[model samples]
Target: MRQGRDNGFQAPLWRAIAVYRIAALTYATILVVRNVAHYQRPVLAWPVVAVMLAWTVFTTYAYANPVRRRPPLLIADLLLTAAALAASVPVVGRQALEEGKPTLAVAWHVAPVLAWAVAGGRRAGITGALLMGATDLIVRAHRDQAALTGSVLMLLAAIAVGYLVRIAEVAQERLQRAIELEAATRERERLARDIHDSVLQVLALVKRRGAGLDGEAGELARLAGEQEAKLRSLVAARSVPADGDDGTDLMTLLSRQESPNVTISGPAEPVRLPPGTAREIAAAVAAALDNVERHCDPGTRVYILVEDAPDEVVVTVRDDGCGIETDRLSQAQAQGRLGVAQSIRGRIEDLGGTVAIVSAPGQGTEVEMTVTRLT
Candidate 1:
């Protein structure tokens, strides 16, 4: 980020730099204009002219360049500050010698410290203080009545401002990071819901119908179902990267809180399922029962069982109803009807598991899905 030269300790670093550059130029222009009557006095005019030119060039560079150019910019800042301080010493010296008392040189000391705070960052501000202090000492060293106490107090204040400027820079960076994270999380959730409702749902239906049929037609439905489940899982696990990506996870991004009707049965022990296994298993079971609820009897009794073992976790859902004929499902698939083929079988296989269907005429359908956890 780039900002102009207004180096207020509280504002963002870039804006401070931009403000500093403009203020420095304005100060230089005003100094020259106000001292127009002193043009003939080369002793005073020449140094002011030199300092004005140096401050303009340095402030311009600091404002234009980013943090990548900080090294070179920092070096130039130090040089410009040194020149400004050197110019101030002679001007201050002439004042003390003529007036016999030290007077405030606003352009010489105060403006330079403000410029350091804006364009040069913390180190630059400290450098300005040291130079300002040195210039005060130079004029005071010659006299027994130099105000050492006031000069030291002003130098310490400049150092304190430098540390405050650093704190402000850190705070700005953190705020930007937090905003980016919030936006990404919201986008991920939206994608998940869309995929789950439309794409994954179609795939699940295809798998279920395929399982209902027998022979070659049933096999085809099974293949289509497996593909859909994998796609859904992939969509649920994705994340957006720093470079800005529209990424999403299938389960989390797609599935909503709209609870599915599921019946689970198994041992009391927690099943050690694979990464995507448990969620997909639950989805497949829910999809199956949905089909049973819609196609079979409204009061159909469905049973779910979870078997936990050392190698695998098996989930079985059984429903009592008339079994499906193999031939009718093929004709349905040809017409692109995927209700049973994609939804159930495809989901189970995607989790590195198997879907077992057992049915014969009046002997109701039973689906046994087994997922093996690799750890």
Candidate 2:
């Protein structure tokens, strides 16, 4: 995901440079026309015209081809601005010598201040101010009443404009980064919620059942508790796949199903299972616990175990509650109660697994589930 975003971020730099080149040239051409009359003398007008054209062409080419060529463009822009300002010196001198006071002819040379702000930023703005100030000083050297204060103010204004443009660019970049982080965080939270409601619910029941047993049942309960703890740790761990399809720990799914009120028992080691198989088994375990919670006494405990081998994984969920009567069990199923059939047995069936119930009068209930893992 990050690689794709980086590629997108870099894609526009070259294109933007290319467009800026055309825009800079167009701006230079308009400036030349507005000051055409002052350049009636071929020696003064032609040289300034040539320098302006060169500045426009060189800057355009440097910025257009490659976005990574920023250093070269920066150097070139600075050099071109210097050359253009140098050419203005002769024209400014001729205008000042002919006219008694400073005229608009010299003012025309300061128009490049806008270009400096657009292309080079704060440093360029400051450089442009210094260059403009020098030219103004040269033109006003012959006049007694020419003010230096106005030239200082103009330089300060150009520098301020450049800083503002640079600040706006920085703000835009920060805003884009903030948006991407927010999106990634939201996706992580959504997946966490799904895991909590489904797989985690089943593990809680198993842990509860494990806490109430004795002897082998007690050992099974201890194993389930371990599995429950592992699942909780995995969920809290940052190593989980960002996308749920990357993979999921089967034992972790079962562990997440645990609850304080429900005792559980399960396998000692994690039983590797595919995502589909694990999802079904986890869902079945949850439905079984839901039955225990809803139909059995509040104090009932459950036991869970996982038997995994080369071809299949099996899960057993048992509850120490009043055993289901044969007639009542049948009646519960007939009255549109699909909790066990659809939520438990049906899910395992979809994953090529089998579910069986073992119970009799005066005895607790047990559910055995087997899912064949396809290599």
Q: What TM-score does model 2 achieve against the real structure?
A: 0.44
Strongest candidate by lDDT? 2
Candidate 1: tens digits of C-alpha lDDT, residues 246-300: 2222223222211223334555433434435556666787787776767675345
Q: Tell me the deviation in Å of residue 106 in model 2.
A: 5.6
Give one digit per residue, the lDDT tens place, for model 2 in 106-129: 443444554454455667767767
Q: lDDT score, residue 162, model 1? A: 65
Model 1, position 216: C-alpha lDDT score: 84
